[model samples]
Target: MFCCYESGFGKVNRFVALFARQSVVNEPPLGASDFKAAPLLQTHLLKHGQGGSGSAGSNFFRALALFGAGASGLLSCATIAYASDEAEHGLECPSYPWPHKGILSSYDHASIRRGHQVYQQVCASCHSMSLISYRDLVGVAYTEEETKAMAAEIEVVDGPNDEGEMFTRPGKLSDRFPQPYANEQAARFANGGAYPPDLSLITKARHDGQNYVFALLTGYRDPPAGVSVISASQALLCFVL
Candidate 1:
């Protein structure tokens, strides 16, 4: 079985952090070496000024302003070039303030219910939730009775009978959600070489999580004049409806 978790902090790191919290400042008296650079650095700084209380100072300010304008123009050009190159890396979506955003906030149950319904009616035909079971939905998206009823609706493949035959039975809370295809080869054939990925932990693997998924699902577009690209709808034409 595979499992995943984030290691936010370790014992050693925690100990160091605690020690840092209790730390007090201590200073050693400055030695001769500390003063060594002070006079020289001051002299260097003094040399940079064109003049003080003179026409030379006004000229220096004017030159400085001109240099600033030129530098700003170059920086803007570089910024444009960098943005053009970064454009090929792909677009970034603005962070949406979700309903459950803060540490104390909880997910919207209604939205969860609606998403599950959409997944069941549409995405389930192509995708699988292999890691999730009906029991997992209880109290999250549905009541225990509702989850059991949903589980029962799908016929599950079960163990061998007394005659040593594999049999189909009503699904139970313990049964994992079924795969659309029995195996990868069949899945590839059905989806034109693109095996639909399991939806379990799908968004978690993406950089922007569910927000990324929402953008991807809604970001379909026609390719530019001569460009061509295949999409899920094009590949799954047989099951698009």
Candidate 2:
């Protein structure tokens, strides 16, 4: 029985190692240092077998324990490699002084107003803010009268009338922000086969999203030596803050 258990343990270890190697191969080529032995081992057992009560189960548990040491070594290596890459690239972002920085601080109304102006004059040309209506801006950025006036500048397509035809009318406070293009196909055609993403909720979608936007807008610089800048007819606009 002891000899049989030893054989089973060996088989399981070899199988786990083989499985781990395949997983490493399938992972996208991050540098060789990104993979650690422990994650591979843990991943192997997680993929292969659940805890059970027979000799087979005992062998699996024992194999998992043996793999644990190597797994820790692997995790440490991966963490070091990641830290080195970040250091080499200088990818850390600069912090912004947001108006609502502290717990007690209220939003900076003036800054919000300025940002709205920038979005209207620049971002609105290409990106849509479909989730926002003119009425949504009334209390925060503009007065009711101003919001209504702004909405009136755009012509919205209304329903089929008695003639069963779509008709156009001046936009209302209830209408969504007008899209720059009629549809996705038109947008892509106008933008060199690339569709611009909507700006609505963009700040909420990414990690440190607000700072990311601030960094991107202010981050444009000459490319490093030997790198070439490929200019498109319509450049995506976030690079100028």
Candidate 3:
């Protein structure tokens, strides 16, 4: 038997059972000699709350309703499960424009140059793009001499001397991007216990990488009514961005 709850109307566990009891499975087929079976089917159905004659049409419709309710419940459960999964993994940000490969769709070189400038001027103060080197920008964004010059502007830590002491030297094209903090502890201390994430591969790590970054950069606003605000430190980070 099926069970269903109806708000302000009590439980309805007996609906299916009642229908089953009045079902016409055991009844013989209607024939000239078996005219009494029709009345028997009607009598059985009437006992189950179906008023008047229990025609095949009425019984079929009742079954359909029961099936529909069960299916709806299953669908609702599946939807809830899907939503839970999304919440567990964190909600995805809205998609925005990204570079694509096609005849008309290509990386915006001008935008890339401007964005690189922004990263170097603003974001590099806290975040690190350690996976990339100055040499990686050649051809895609910068010329070989420009990339080498940019690398030379930074001082990088190098090998120990014969006396076993580390030394600093001009950064080379092969050297990884420099970091603002020496270690994780220093980073946390500088940011009030919040360690900035590395920006290398960030565009690939997020669901809608470019769009998510753009939204985060510009989406700082008062949350809607009933929305709980984030912690003060995180809120501060958002505003700073």
| Cand. 1 TM to true fold | 0.57
Per-residue lDDT of 1-241 in model 1, one digit per residue for the tens? 0011112222223322332232323234223453342333333323443233334433443554465456556666887888786665365654678878789999999899999999989999989999998899999999999999999998987779999999999999999998888899999999878888788998897656777777667655554566544543322111121
Candidate 3 stretches greater than 4 Å from native: 1-82, 88-92, 99-104, 222-241
Our model 2 lands, by Cα RMSD against the true structure, at 12.8
**What TM-score goes with each of the models?**
0.57, 0.58, 0.56
Candidate 3 C-alpha lDDT tens digits along 1-241? 1233342112222333344444545443223332232333444444543433546645664665577578668767887988797776454666654566456887877777788889999999999999998888888778899889999999988879899999999988999989989999999999999999999999788645777677678766665556665553233223233
Q: Lowest-scoring 10 consecutive residues by lDDT in candidate 2?
A: 29-38
Candidate 1: 10-residue stretch with minimal lDDT: 1-10
lDDT of 2: 0.70
Clashing pairs in 3: none
Candidate 1 residue spans exceeding 4 A from truth: 1-89, 221-241
Q: Which has the greatest TM-score?
A: 2
Clashes of each: 0, 4, 0
Choose 2 or 3, whichever is better by lDDT. Answer: 2
State which candidate, 2 or 3, has the greater TM-score: 2
lDDT of 2 by residue, 69-95 (tens): 465566668879877876664455667
lDDT of each: 0.65, 0.70, 0.67
